[model samples]
Target: MDPFVVVVLSLSFLLLLSLWRQSSGRRNLPPGPTPLPIIGNFHLIDMKNTRQSFSNFSKTYGPVYTLYFGSQPTVVLYGYEALKEALIDHGEEFSGRGSFPMLEKVFKGKGIAFSNGNVWKAKRLFTVNTLRNLGMGRRTIEEKVQEEAQWLVKELKKTNGSPYDPHFIMGCAPCNVICSIIFQNRFDYEDKDFLSLIGKVNECSKILTTPECQENGNQQTIYSLDHLASLVTGLFFAGTESTGTTMRCALLLLLKHPHITAKVQEEIDHVIGRHRRPSMQDRIHMPYTNAMVHEVQRYADIAPNSMVHEMTCDTKFRNYFLPKGTTVIASLTSVLQDSKEFPNPEMFDPAHFLDGNGNFKKSDYFMPFSTGKRVCVGQSLASMELFLFLTTILQNFKLKPLVDPKDIDITPIGSIFSTIPPTFQMCFIPI
Candidate 1:
């Protein structure tokens, strides 16, 4: 062969080899919606309503679909089976919570919610045990809730059955409960620092739900005001807004379904009586109320998307490979709205948790708190707060709509990190 011909053939072979390597590198990634260069799929995300948009995307791309937002690759797990498999069945493989550069900057590894590995393990365990020791799931906690509820009732009564916004007042009540558990004290409604903290938290929540922040450019440092702002906002939004919104949803639902409300009141009145306050011990006996609370959680479906979980090490789910550092998000909304599991998922029916004989029935699919190791650290405390605040409020007063029920919009406002909760005026008519 000619020397020139041999050299030309070798150069062509090397060029083809380089192209093959590039194509193979792309193939190694999980399939996802086509992402734009640099931006990825950040443009496609509905930062305002992430759960709804992601749910719609999951329908098109199957349960385990990949999405790129900014430089991060996110694996979304839709529906009960997928979420359960990721968070429970193959939990260890998907246990690590995804760490964003901004989040690291804010948290600086202080709390249970964001920390990972042994640090997360120790913090979460300590937090949970501390809450329990503080009587979070017991009668002592109930007394605190009852005290707050009485104060709220007095405030509502002062409204003289006039229409009023309950969002701010209602929100502060539950945040105070968590504050008592964490800080060993509750905040008065007028306290300056307490109110300032709540304001900061609310602002942070708004920033989180907004799409504007995503355009702020990639941050490298682990701590910055932007990150801290987002972190505080996320904590307040998650800690207060979620539990509060669920209670609001429950109140609205009870008002619309008077018969159910009546039943709950009767049950509460029967077990605890009008003279005394309802206790946590009464939860088992007041099955209807327990079932109703569970239904509220299911229907409200707050935190539709569980916190994104990251793979600390290369892991495999069934045969699907999840590479190290891949972000996994469990869609709680899909699971709660599963038609197969809930029959009529859209309807707000308390019967979903009730048996033929009217006894409370626990369903395996009711996972509002999620599951596995990284499951909500506040689950036990949130449950106690929800049940106590809700039942106590209902026992003392009836939530009467100020206008036609149809005019009272339950549709959420604000961005998607947490439900903004609807704005409506109601008269808390004393029973």
Candidate 2:
């Protein structure tokens, strides 16, 4: 017998035994399509539409199911109830942050979004406190959002009803708001340094998959000065990206639905009027406008998968056991598009958030910033931003599409991570 053949047989036997053990170990996990070793269920996924793939998997596997991203078994909570149970009901148990490889290389497990255990809790607390100090969700922050909204309006006025590509302007407004919060000063839209920074922030998504983690002066470790840079980057990236994308998507949707846009403008006229900018106080009296904002978030459905979360401790949930550090996805797309909660959810209707009396109706399933213990730290800031910016724009200008409203495509040109509106030039016809 050849020794080479003997070695081959031994290796084959060991590999088979390891695979057998892997299959047997998954008995306690919920249930899903069986995964192949190594690549696991990568074959089961459409890499492009991963969230939709996860959502589709729910139809076959029911609400709670297991998937293997490589050898790691992931438990997905599909619909609203399952998500609420795991994320909110078992909040503490599921509070740990999970891995996003593209982000981990940059964050290095040092920041609020990706850090776990005590570091996560501390970082989160510090961030929340820092945001609060910077006037997040308060009247002070409202003023900042309003100021930016005014600046945005002024910038639009410069267009003088000419056709303009608003992509950069839309990004600049929210980016500056975050800049103020993080750096304590906003930049002029034309400033070269500010433009460069924005380029880096937007490029982070495009380039992160192959990101070379740049070295700074301090390279000690987590909690080191190098990590401090990662922390600020994490906050700045998150703060600007989602809010800006939502605003862009919301605007695109408005252009697509001229009648809906008319209604929102009508409400703005009736409540806040042109005399004053929309305020948080105005939000209560302006039910239709508020509903429109909420519906935009639901219908836009950016950040569909939300941030992946992890289990803090080994826990038995429902009939299956999820080990500590098990990655869990509470599908925001599933909850946002849940037909049960919002009738004809695929249609962009403000009535989904409105009642028979036309008052704003709150739905537990509206988790765009997501819900639970680890909900987006800037949720309040984002909400205020949406209302103020959207209303302000409508108050000053009527969004005129070059094509007919029916022809306008509201579909997001999304990447794996977030949604982006198609590149468009529109006439910001003054109201």
Best by lDDT: 2
Per-residue lDDT for 218-254 in model 2, tens only?
2244456756777788877877777777788888888
Model 1 lDDT per residue over 90-148, tens place = 78878887764544555655455666676566555655665678786677777777787
TM-score of 2: 0.92
How many steric clashes between backbone atoms does each model show? 2, 0
Off by over 4 Å in 2: 1-15, 207-224
Record all residue pairs in model 2 with backbone atoms less than 3 Å apart, i.e. clashing. none
Model 2 score (lDDT): 0.82
In model 1, which regions exceed 4 Å deviation? 1-26, 42-49, 100-105, 211-238, 414-416
**Ten-residue region with minimum lDDT total, candidate 2:** 209-218
